[model samples]
Target: MAFRKFSFLSLVAGGVAQTGLAPKKFNSLPLGAIRPAGWLSDQLNVQMNGLAGHQHEIHLDVSQVNNTDWTGGSGYYSNLEEAGSYWFNAAVPAGILSNNAVFNNLTLNFLNYVIDHQDSTGWLGPEVGTTKPRYLWGRYPFFFGAIQLVEHDPTLADRVVPALHKFVQVANTMLHNNGEGVDDWAATRWEDFVMALQWLYDFHPNGNEALLIDTMKMLKATGDPWEQVFATANFPTKAVDNTPNPFPVLTWHGVNMAEGLKALPSTFRFTHNQSDLARASEGWDNLFKFHGRPSGIFAADEYLAGLEAHRGTELCLVVETMFSGSFLYQVAGDPKYADRVRSFSSVAHSQPLTPRHMWTRQYLQQQNQIAAKNMTPNPFPNDGPYSNVFGLEPNYRWPKFITNSFVVTPDNKSLVQVYLGPFSTSTTLAGNNAVTVTVDTQYPFSDTVKTTVKAAQAFTYLVRIPSWVVGGTIAVNGAKATAVAPSNGLHAVNIAAGTTSLVLNLPAPITTESRPHGAIAIHRGPLNYAFDIPRTQKILARNAAEPRAVDLEFDSSGTWQFAIDPSTLKFVPRTVSALPSPVFDQAKPPFSMTVTACPISWSVAGDTFAAVPPTSPRCTGANTTLTLWPYGATKLRISEFPVMHA
Candidate 1:
């Protein structure tokens, strides 16, 4: 198949010809277009009831209460980066998706404050004057959040768009002036800045196309050479060491690599270079081949940790990787990228990155983690001793926000790009017909999906068939089911006006993956099964003044040293009246699996972290049926186990 290039204008309504711009395969809908339903709604509520909803009131230092950088105060930049920007980013989607009025109002107030306080010289954040050095890295996230807000609530667009234009003008001037204000962090992850620029150009250029294009070009030139790095031998294939080398900062940094994954693809949009797109794909494959964990994220506590299951993968890296995967799926239209987005959203989010409540988060999560405590000589190369402990702002904090799983097809149809939990969306299709799509299913937990479409006129509804699915079927209104022969991984069904029903069943079977050190990981559908170990939580700080801001440590109370017999694995379905409040809670998993296993001598490194699984270790104790929960449900778990032969 010949590689195709698209124009950004081609996807928009009545878009004008814009030369030298690469086209996107898909474009995301506004914030409230898709709203959470079923267990997905419950997950968002859990976050709102936890830290995300109340961070400003509790985490005084980092939250917007004191960090008035974007609100015109001269607060520290780190505070905005760590908490303020991330809080707004998560809160906006959570608010719009869940329809929480308070969260919506809170986000709107912040937006108004920032927009109202824009500096006269087009500066957006706390770095206001030319007398001191200004860092442009912090403003990128704040603008990302601002862009989302304007997308969802366009009432602010008239104001927000103008503010953004002014800021970009100043940014272009700064970049052209010997790349002033472009620091190492901003230079390494300039793709995010380019993404914001591209969104503006695609949607609201308002006759400023030249300025947006020149700014993107300058940013790309100032940024790291991600295309060459990924395309050539410069990419790191091994665990990065602390000792300095000739490698650029993007090669070893985990978050940068995750964010940088979109650099070449975003660059391809403007450059229209197929090699740039191809190299982006190459970089993604290489990153996971050398550093991927069973939980669907690459290892990089701070740097590129290798494939050792014991190495910690940062929570920030997981979120950024998901975002990058989403971008890749949208621009490249690859089923593999969508498949990864689904896997990472289901498995990595369920892992011990954060508790069910979403109150506290880990700096680094380990696949072989058995204890969540402060460690002496921590296993993470670039993290502190307390990296694994869950706290309000463990090392640095960034809340996990929901990414758009649906895309607006160029033909004005809505496409389910990534299959997630139950959700519904209302949008206009071709012929100016209004349509509402309601997907009802416990997906990633169950293989069956039931979609109900209510439309004023007939239209085609598209859903992606994951790469793992084979011989899937789609039935319309209980009629004879047809085999789903996907073209480019999408199964499209024609629907009549008024109301229509769709039942899609993608068979999910138990599968095993061979891991590092001769260990094995189990998967059924999108969920990865792990050995759930019992643990006792200890509050690291019991400050009466700040009860909710205290840190927590978890110690394993049950035996975690086990090698599984994969042949004995059996899927066990549990009947529940309703899924629990915290969907990822260990006590209320909707379903689980039972497998015969025996105790083994899996030693510990650093006196706390579990060592690498022994290669084909012999079971020392009698075989027993052990219940395995979803990877996300367990706080202390062994996801990758040594294979014990029967």
Candidate 2:
């Protein structure tokens, strides 16, 4: 029965409808050259709430984003700054990708956003017009044309590449025209040149040699100090204070740049100049040396603070790193990069993005991401004010901390990492192999990930058994199977020719925990488990002073629940040591913070205060009790406490 169910999963994931037809030459464009359009295209359906053939609805949203008068400097509720053409970039492609009904319209409209704004003096930013960051904005066309027209339209590339080069030169001259240049001379110039090279190389593989030589000479001339440091890695270019304890080592920015250079592998496979490749290699060496964090992250915060908890790590940096890493994977053609890209995007970014798809926090403290309080109170962020974990911020669309917007080509082969969401992938398998994998299962919470592989051939399918999977049963046709082949996370699978059946049953993750602190952050799979306080804004701070005693119990039916705050959860020493919990190792002492007796409560929203509200408002303070639930399941339970003595 399980085998039958898995068979159906693969059939629905369709790919390469025209495999029998002659194949069109794939456009060999550099990854991260202009930001991938196929990545954007694949996400349209999900981002627009399953935009499958729903082209009109997308056009409407795109239109709104393009309407400067309507949007008018952010939304009315929150006085946040607005992107000049927030709608144009988002809407244009959404319409273009939905189908070609308005392709020309969106294409021209997007071009207006790109070309019209550059000044003769060479300045581009949102401040100039709808388009901001001239060089960054310039690369969008490159990405948009990648899937459909990178190679096919020779005339288009001839015109576009040269024009792009001219615009960048003008933009650079504005910044580095003389000795006095922008404060961020190296970072900006590096990005601009890299992007330009990617565009020229994409259009003309044997691109303008004179132009390339001239650009390299320009870089060698003027000769900024950053170039030598980046190219040579003399001593890792760093700003001290990366660790939570502030042991001076590496900064995140340096790590991001290094990763960017690694992206060159995905961008260019064959290069004539060895010097450029050598320069890129040195940057990568420094990337791992100083900035790599224990959490498998490159320490990058706006503050340049080391990899310490409570020190800020910007959400934007995480997205960019993952995006850049994906480019590196494409460039290096290494499975390790793919594995990191797939896992980090899921564990870090995808998990944080809220299901509601609104309001994302700008920063995350790695050590204590599970603080239940709002931390907005105490008129400071470092301290707790609200009951943490289940809180909301407006303007942050979707809690997805990292947006991994790329399609997994499940044609002939596929790879699964962080098995949590519902996915249907279509890919071309070996020698015109058409395979589609439609995985349908309530997993992570469930041990068995019901997977089905529907393909045109009967070939060996390599299913990655996660490290967490200690033991599992593999059933083929209801008869138990003893062995599976090529079990590593990386491998190109070939299903046997002329057979469309492949089913793999995976085991569940086993975990045990012990709590040493007064509070514990619950977790289920990638989601950090939480106590949901469900009430309007009024349900604030009622449980601010309460400490949850860990008492997680799973029922015989496999429904697990944690019974905490034993009615007497106050200034009490933790007695429940044997409970599933997060690792907060005080013995390591890598993180620094002073514990205090500063107890706080949530406001009832009656008065104007400067503190973050509690996680859940108290349903009642008059001898009323509140029950807690998880954050994702917002329909029931009270997360905050009633603040009453037992």
Candidate 3:
């Protein structure tokens, strides 16, 4: 199939004039429109069973905080404040509006508290320092949640719009004076403010809302200069040691990079400057090239730690990268941007091995393989029972919530699949109210997807063909579609009103890639397969303030040092009669696979699996059978291993 380049405006109304390529304009469905179906739905339901999703408990705590004087008051810093931020902005509102009954009323008390208590001037958040308005950073999440609330219930728009205008006026004044320190967190995280303000600018009922966003962008730029930072694109060198900084560099901090990655992309949405787009794309390339792991993210055990197989990525950084990619894909309208989202999504949802308690800790205290500048020395430094304590919420279970599964085409008439999984959705097309779509498949585990569309009238359907899928085929109404071809990572098909079944078969070949230090990473489909090492967990208090806060230490009983026989890298797939409940449970993965391997002489480094396995070491043991599990499903695992040479 031939490809064509088109402008973003073609997708403005969710309608498109196709000239042989997938349309560029695509927007997300309403927060709750397309929901998780099949095993994906089960995973979300399981998450709600824990603190992460216990809507009432989480929101109740949030309401109590909201009712207090901490938000834009004297006692603001008394609590983390973000504990409430995640509940309103992330957890409850999205879940509730998504039609999940579990979140019912969970969003109510919190919304009511904000409505009743928000100062007449539109100030929200704790009032700290002499400045009348506090930090710009804290208010962003509040508005993020408010936007979600307004979408779920439009009546709140009456209150939300005016309140935001007032807040914008106050923020504009602060930036004009350049006197108050309102730029504290906002200086470092100016991109997030851009994200929230842009949403307000796009969706606000008042057409003049763009002015508010203009003021915000102008003011925020003067403070942090993230736009300049991105345009110059200088800071993060290939390795931390290579940078000019003589001390620990806060500039390349993982969370900051994740949040800042979207700076240029978001700015391009307003400026339409081609330079911003180029810099945005260049930023992503540099990040992945120097620091990216097989999981499609760079090593930032809090900061840029260079590319080492075993260096752990902070869960927050992982989540933030996913968020940034979500924005970049829509802004750039490039399938490769969407492809990056899929890569981060798969690793985050399927192989997130980091325990929940350590998520909030700034530094990942894991076994380091390569030693570099500002990194903790290897072989276990003992300093009176060391715990790099950062008293923050662990939020381990929240990664499952870090996804926006579908995007409504810019015309609002069609839909595009972004995060691949079993899902169902309906959009108004040809003036029909009930055009239903049900997508059934165990994606990643199984590449075959069967989408059944039932429409009262005809509508166009666009399904994203991931970059990894080659020689993919589509069968419509049980017949192979010989005439249609998908080249730009998408396939467009027209569906007539009556029941139409589309079966898509994506090639899931067993593949391997060579890694640093003679290591190799294995994959089948979207999942990265790993050796599920047998181990026991030793629990330790995460800190003194919150003794209940704990971290896990694993002691493995099984040997982890092994080399796969590349010629013998066979995959035996199993189809289960039913998916296991609590599917993410480490020992109870929904699917299973077995492979053959040979044990090699391996050594440990930094009291954990060595960074690099011995390259082509002498075979210390006969060929043996080893079971490989999904990387996300294992608590203790070695996903990359040495390729042995006998």
Q: What is residue 79's positional error in candidate 1, in angstroms?
A: 4.6
Candidate 3: residue 463 Cα off by (Å): 0.4
12-50: candidate 1 lDDT, tens digit per residue: 224544364677888787877877788878876776666
Model 2 lDDT, full chain set: 0.34
- Please, what are the lDDT tens digits per residue for candidate 3 over residues 232-347? 34655555644574322444677777777877776666555556667778777778877777666667655676666655566577777877777777777677777776665545
User: Where's the lowest-lDDT run of ten residues in candidate 3?
Assistant: 366-375
Highest lDDT scorer: 1
| TM-score of every candidate relative to the true structure | 0.92, 0.51, 0.83
Model 3: how large is the Cα RMSD against the reference?
A: 7.3
Worst window of 10 by summed lDDT in candidate 1: 1-10
Top of the candidates by TM-score: 1
Between candidates 1 and 3, the lDDT winner: 1
Question: Model 3, which residues run further than 4 Å from truth?
Answer: 1-24, 54-81, 97-104, 128-133, 179-184, 205-207, 223-237, 245-250, 349-392, 396-403, 429-434, 481-484, 541-551, 590-595
Q: What is the C-alpha lDDT profile of model 2 across 81-125, one tens digit per residue?
A: 123233332333344334445543544444444444445554333
Q: Answer with 2 or 3, whichever has the higher lDDT.
A: 3
